[model samples]
Target: MTEEEIIRPENLVYKKPTLLNDTPMHYCPGCSHGVVHKLVAEVIEEMGMENKTVAISPVGCAVFAYNYIDVDWVEAAHGRAPAVASAIKRLWPDRLVFTYQGDGDLACIGTAESIHALNRGEHIAIIFINNAIYGMTGGQMAPTTLMGMKTATCPYGREADLHGYPLKFTEIAASLEGTCYVTRQSVHTVASIRKTKKAIRKAFENSMNGKGASLVEVVSTCNAGWKLSPEKANQWMEDNMFKFYPLGDLKDTATANDSH
Candidate 1:
């Protein structure tokens, strides 16, 4: 069979219910955002939360995530997904609420919103994708950009003196008394993707259980921003990003094991 026939629409089995409207994605080749988008949809299907779930889209590469994840979603102002999530969850306390955001939007522009949201102990799940650099804004230096990392605006490589240290968001979230679940996982490999799906599902479950705030920080890849092939990009995330954002549960056991 031809390659097209191998991946035909009918050949694909979507076992889970997806609220995502039918539309093609605009992500670059080898982008992990697409994989993550699919994982969220799958989790929503598995948990039967698509009808009662609401997602919040951020301002970075994933700003259009609402189009791909089958669920009710709102577009939040840059760096304000957490705030938007708080508002939505407050209004509809029974809904399973989440926010899909990138490092640039979550760690930089939205730092205040993020910190305050967690501090307030809102009932919502946060799906944070840390790709290191700014993927959408022409590969600029993001707050999570590692030292010695090269980006369009940092051709000389990011330096501690100038760019500051890599922000450990999971660690920060873990410190919050209100945060119920905090885990850092990756989507760079099959094993890691399996773990990431579990983390995502756990976060959603925590939200449904009214367990306060939950954050799953996904160490994802930005192939275009990193200027690496898909294989190399995944390798970089596994080797480098994993060192900084280790995979595991960082908070309460109930929320951590909710998916299981």
Candidate 2:
């Protein structure tokens, strides 16, 4: 079929999100950042918030999100995306504001900023990408690195006596009174991707509706950092990662309020 005929509305099964620009992403092979970016772009476009959205990108693998997603973006210092997002959201209450951050940036250096922002009930969403290890920084041990998981900084595996346990920031966010929604999700399969997309949409809606803070943690994979192929990485995440960071809504005050 001709290109035009193949892309006709009636013949289309799916299409790329209009908010996703043609710029090539710099993520490593099998990186989860690309998929999450696409989902964010899709959600923004679907909500008709393309012109009224502001994204905060901080240092890490997703720092370059502004290059691909066609949205107003602010580049923040390492671990400070939450603070910047809070300022932006407060200044422009009508805009849909969010921060895209990796585990190392959110759970480690930005721990205080993240906690306070969510605790204060900022009208914004935080998209947390937890791949365990620090993917962009030479695969070092991250705050969310699973116990016993090997990384460059933990060649002999993470020892409880030396490294402490992995931080479950999502659970912490859920416990905060200011948080209206919190969910842990993944994109390893078609079904999981669909669910994650739904979770992201709900968080965005809650933010725009003057609800309290929301967080969507995506349990992700880093094949290069883990020294595994794409297929093996997916399997490893399913077998190992999910055991500790199981998927589901940790809190859902938004839906609860709606039902009442």
The count of residue-pair clashes in candidate 2 stands at 0
State every prediction's TM-score relative to the real structure: 0.90, 0.97
Q: Rate the local accuracy (lDDT) of all candidates.
A: 0.86, 0.95
Instruction: Please give the clash total of every predicted structure, in order.
Output: 3, 0
Cα lDDT of candidate 2 equals 0.95
Model 1 earns a TM-score of 0.90
TM-score of model 2 (CA atoms): 0.97
Candidate 2, residue 109: how far the Cα is off, in Å = 0.8
lDDT value for candidate 1? 0.86
Clashing pairs in 2: none
Local lDDT at 238 for model 2:
95
Alpha-carbon RMSD of each model: 3.5, 1.6
lDDT of 1 by residue, 43-139 (tens): 8888987689888997988898877776787998899999988988999999998999999899899999998898788989999999998998899
Identify the leading candidate in terms of lDDT: 2
